[model samples]
Target: MAAYGYFLSCEEFSPSQLLEQARMAEQAGFEALAISDHFHPWNDEQGQSAFVWSMIGALSQVTSLPVTTLVTCPTVRLHPAINAQAAATSAVLTDGRFRFGIGTGEALNEHILGDAWPEASQRMDMLEEAVQVIRELLTGEQVTHHGPHYTVQNARIYTLPEQPVPIYVSGFGPQAAALAGRIGDGFVTMTPDADLIGRFRSAGGGGKPVIGGLKVCWDTDRDRAVKTVHRLWPNEQLPGELAQVLPTPRHFEQAAELVTEEMVRKATTCGDDPDEHITAVRAYTDAGFDEVYVNQIGADQRQFFDFYRTRVLPDLPRSR
Candidate 1:
């Protein structure tokens, strides 16, 4: 059994649209919310990237559902200490319902500061150190550290929630899973791979929650929906480390040109089939994920919510 949530894509929608979707998600019976933290859209047609911390503040005023960044990178572009403060403030604003989801991050966002992009292994080391720094700062005690990747001098977060913010670490492979298991309060990934979940548990994540998500297109016309996904999110089909290494939206667009509509159709659930959507989500639950988030790829969000409210959610297995 798992709790189902809606994923708010900052890469695809405006801040106002995201706030409205948060409201709609709660109203339509979603149990929680997952929002992407991106400095830029994957492609131009996606067209929007709001500062996620500011959007979180607005979300606090709009919805009562718990929110998690799915996820943010604390290792580059911004120091982990700065992110700790932002997460602390977000936790307070959400009344202790914010889950801090973090990762090693992608070059597309991290490279903007013109810092040399580290290799995968080095980035992993930096992520471990960044997580350590963030956790220490979240305790609200003054912290002074001279680590391999970061430096903090008597730094402390003045504002924090009554409970410490739970940090969910994201990973897509065995090494990263082991790191997440050893250090994370919870684990985040986009796929529902039971073997990966087992790897996490074996590495010491046994009692911690596992979170995953997927995207779908809901529309009256299946072909049109496929085209919408092809145009707006062909980047999703770009395989391997390309997503983590690509430096900019233009580069992503260039890479996405290799993706085809047939590929998008094969990978995503498109059109108005409730059973298809239900089955897509069930994959996560079946793979032992504690929570699963679903993102509607195109602009039919209100309709998607309504359809899920009436046709999908009631049929899914509940956590209880």
Candidate 2:
């Protein structure tokens, strides 16, 4: 069955705003909540980046819906042992409703720690090792490891859930997708690419859930919304390694100069009507996602939720 959910821009909102959004999302019948875990926003203009672990703690108390980090990098910013403890505590606090979603991550976030960012193959290798370390720590037993990528000594998670939390891995390419299939309990990705999911399952992810997300702007003025998205999120259009090599927001701003507002509008749904949002989400469903999460851009949070609840949600193809 396909589940519908909301993806909160955790790096773009204050902790208080996120708490309120979580409450409202639950009230609006969202089945799950996904939060972005970034060390920094792509651009300084976005204005917020709270530590996601703390935000998840607050979210657990404020809503009944299940929560997952849309994607977090286990390889950088935090050590796998520490990540395991954080996930364990979050699972307990949320009563086992938290899923730990991990990935190799972007340079924009990981580079802040001053660690040398590795090549894609090396990052994937490190990700696999990190996952193993995290899983061991989550077992609530003392763990020690000296892997090629990370070293751990006598680490244990004291506040684990009765059951281990599911791990969802995000994969952008074929190799990473196969790894996700082999190691992850579930799969997470941004684009509506069923071929990638098929690759995942074929690689051994049988019966595992696949989650996808998309960005949209709901507003009365379509053109204005598109312009706003381009202005604020222009980095989305940049392809490949530029996103990784760029060191600062100013670098992103310079690259963004090449992206047009038309590109943003064509890539995302932007309009007042609920059907537009439905159409955009349907693309993911049709592409074979088990869960399709939508992220509504802009500040009119109430209007966005109300429109989805009243008009968009009913039009979606229900899960069998």
Tell how far residue 30 is off in model 2, in angstroms.
0.8
Error of 2 at 171 (Å): 0.5
| Residue pairs in collision within model 1 | none
CA lDDT of every candidate: 0.94, 0.87
- Please list the residue runs of candidate 2 whose C-alpha ends up more than 4 Å from where it truly belongs after superposition: none
**Per-residue lDDT for 154-258 in model 2, tens only?**
777788899998999999889999999999999998888889989999999998999979888888899888987886788889988786667777788888889
Report how far residue 47 has shifted in candidate 2, in Å.
1.2
Which portions of model 1 show Cα errors greater than 4 Å? Answer: none
lDDT of 1 by residue, 1-320 (tens): 89999999999999989999999999999999999999999999999999999999999999999999999999998999999999999999999999999998999999998999999999999999998999899999999999999999999899989999999999999998998999999999998899999999999999899998999999999999999999999999999999999999999999998999999999999999999999999999999999999999888999999999999999999996
Clashes of 2: 0
Q: What would you estimate as the lDDT of candidate 1?
A: 0.94
